[model samples]
Target: MTTGAPTPTYPARPRRSRLRTFLPLGVAAWLVLEIWLLTVVADATSGLVVFLLLLGGLVLGSVVVKRAGRRAFQALNEALQRGGTPESGGGNGLMMLGGLLIMLPGLVSDALGLILLIPPVQKTLSRYAERTVDRKLRAASAGSFGDAFQQARIHRPDGKIVPGEVVRDQPGDEPQGPVPPLTR
Candidate 1:
């Protein structure tokens, strides 16, 4: 209890979130499973069959992605013609995601990608995603990303808030030339 010198204290390190801690491990396990499944399929059938399957998947995925892109572009154009902002994603994003998954090496990815391509599945997923986002936005506090645009205060990393507005230069002011480099 008796000390000649005062004790020094250090700041605690920020804790890692559960998702950050476990995601890598989960991905590694998934990769291992995919590779094992591929090997099993190859052994059951033939190497040529496996090669053909992969090639087919790549082609199908590309086609799906292209179709989704075209649809999204068309929707945007239509919205512009109507003189309004584009509405929510018309399952194009989900379709593209499915395509991306199909393009991946694993059978599980292909299956999931295929599932995403389905109209009903896409609708369900999109609705779920929208609801989740809405919930999160509603729950967000003043400092969260959702509330940043609504507030007038400028939030600083060190918790300082300065209220201000930009004062533009006069119309007659010429644009300043680039600053010269300082000589050593």
Candidate 2:
């Protein structure tokens, strides 16, 4: 046998997605901006006012999230009883997101949250998001995770793919209003 060195083999590292690479940096920048803005507001007015504003936002966001969650649940129940997949929500999910943003401790987030609560804005955002996800899923390679997402769609009896979500109830949630009786 000839004496020769063999090349070592190693598993290739997976490429990082753009969102993964940049999200931390973006979050850091957002935190700095929010802190700076809070200080500016405190300097211009009073720290107590800022505190009150944040508290008010927290309460309002809580209310918004509760209402949206209730509505979404109701819609889901109605759809399940009808034995049909739920139509994409009428912005309740987006409203919940807005509420979450408002709950965050930042004026910028609060402003964005308030804007998202608007019906037109929510619809526009929802459409844009749908289009973007659809584009990404279509562009995904044959054997990738996106292909799994593509396969996860619910197809209608008439043979059109419809996106859907799987809902799970959290602990401590009590059923309110009339819950549909379970059938077959």
Candidate 3:
């Protein structure tokens, strides 16, 4: 048989759908809002005041986000232990996103991102994420590609016909007499 590497038998994963496109757009919008807020806040306040406020916000946000992340992760772990798929927390990612927003020179993004980092908001977002993932998985599994095929060989010399299963003849079974022969 010709061989290098056998061609992959399984189908490739489908590309991301429209829903996947929404996530990045949403993040970008939030980033824009954050920058706007920062500009407004920085312009209204003195440098020292801005520094103090940002520092305090960072400290408070970190504590809250960290606790929330821990709790969410624990819940996910528990679900996995129970033989269930772990739910998305969304909090951890939001927290990081929030931190990034905060680092950018703007008050609006920081506020919005920090809000997202909160446990309750993150929990809701996480639930939404979980539902989305579940839907996609279900859809894929229900499709034809989900069904697998098996290959079998038939023991025919000419390869003109293939026999499948055979039903055994009983001990008392008799063969019919056949005197006629095929004529060319």
lDDT scores of the candidates, listed in order: 0.88, 0.89, 0.68
Better model by lDDT, 2 or 3? 2
Number of backbone clashes in candidate 3:
7
Q: Flag regions of model 2 displaced more than 4 Å.
A: 1-7, 11-15, 140-184
The clash count for each model shown is 0, 0, 7
Residue 36 lDDT in candidate 2 = 94
TM-score per candidate, chains pooled: 0.75, 0.69, 0.44
Model 3 lDDT tens row, 63-142 = 65576578678878899899998765546676766666554555665677677766788788878888999999998677
Clashes of 1: 0
Candidate 3, pairs of clashing residues: 34-108, 34-109, 37-107, 37-108, 38-106, 38-107, 38-108
lDDT of 2: 0.89
Residue 131, model 1: lDDT of 98
Off by over 4 Å in 1: 1-9, 141-184
Which digits, one per residue and each the tens of the lDDT, describe model 1 over residues 1-184? Answer: 7767666555597999999999999999999998888899999999888888889899999999999999999999999999999999699999999999999988989999999988999999999999998889777752766466448677655455766577788989976998576332
What is the alpha-carbon lDDT of model 1 when measured against the actual structure? Answer: 0.88
Model 3 scores worst on lDDT over the 10 consecutive residues at 146-155
